[model samples]
Target: MTLTLDGEKIDRNRFTGAKVENATFHNCDFSGADLTGSEFIGCTFYDRDSRLGCRFSRAQLKDASFKSCDLSMTDFRNVSALSIEIRECRAQGADFRGASFMNMITSRSWFCSAYITKSNLSYANFSKVVLEKCELWENRWNGAQILGANFSGSDLSGGEFASFDWRAADFTHCDLTNSELGELDVRNVDLQGVKLDSEQASQLMERLGILVIG
Candidate 1:
């Protein structure tokens, strides 16, 4: 029986190491709150404009709208936020290892140089995000909307980008070694300074109706 504090602004509260269950925070703000090492199992935090550095390390924010928040440099390692919408936030250098947030909507955010390895982000809409110099290895991006996103200088090795609508995406100077691009349509995507393998280039060409005949 968790308290339904929906659409409320909770500031400077100590939620550290507390297990909150079935709490839905719609259009709420957690400004200056310390949620470090807390277990928010089956809780939702939506519309949080965190400007005072709220911490969220090893927290379980599963199956919720964790949206509209600025979680810059927040410890997001080992968090289970399945189908979460982490939109319009600044999460630079955040570690998302072993985090499962599939079909997420992460648009208009700045995730520059974030360490995101072994994560599941299938069918996600990552539009207009600054992902420059990011270490995105071994992540799932199947059927994702990577439109208008920037992957410049990002090491996207061993990542999957199959069947993604990548029109208007920028992959400048990105490393794509052993990346799964089986059905990636790159017709309107930008490849000005991209660095991919020969087979990967051929796959992109094939998707653009260009047959490679020896």
Candidate 2:
């Protein structure tokens, strides 16, 4: 029985295909909103006594969808969010610095899309976001800042990523299967079409000591 909506503005609202449930939205703004194919369930948008969340700056959010949302410290700066679908969201320290999940064709060619599965996104910032070829599966990303982020050809299979650095984010052809990759320093992060398994490729070849016996 939530339905709070504190500082409501609902900027340029449309809420396309709306289906909202268990709403809260404390510092609500939803700037330039469209929310295409919207479906937010169990929403909160983080208030927690004036901690203030909801903003969605420049939002259009194509194919927007969320589930079990809290969206802690949410802002989602400069959003365009193609095919967005954040599942099991918590979104800790959310900022999404200049988000744009691109779809452009010309002018340096673009191809990005969002899915953001099993989200927690601890310390989320995503500075310089691009989100190329995205799906972003099984998310937690313990300390996600992602400076100059690209996430090239993303899948990010079964992610957790404790204290994530990974050379300040590019993850070329990413799919890090069954991921927990804490300090993934595979010769300074450029595992072209990366898709590690088999005990994380024998723990990154025993940290380059190459002791993957048998």
TM-scores, all candidates, are: 0.49, 0.36
- The window of 10 residues in a row where model 1 has the poorest summed lDDT is 63-72
Distance (Å) between predicted and true CA of 142, model 2? 2.2
lDDT of 2 at 97: 87
List where candidate 1 sits over 4 angstroms from the true fold.
1-111, 185-187, 202-214
Candidate 1: C-alpha lDDT = 0.55
Please write out the lDDT profile of model 2 over residues 123-189, one tens digit for every residue: 8999889887788899898988988888887998999999888898788878889988888878877
Q: Give the range of the ten consecutive residues with the poorest summed lDDT in model 2.
A: 8-17
Error of 2 at 32 (Å): 3.0
For candidate 2, give the lDDT: 0.86
What's the CA error at residue 143 for candidate 1, in Å?
A: 2.1
Candidate 1 C-alpha lDDT tens digits along 156-178:
78877767665656777888778
The superposed Cα distance between candidate 2 and the true structure at residue 175, in angstroms, equals 13
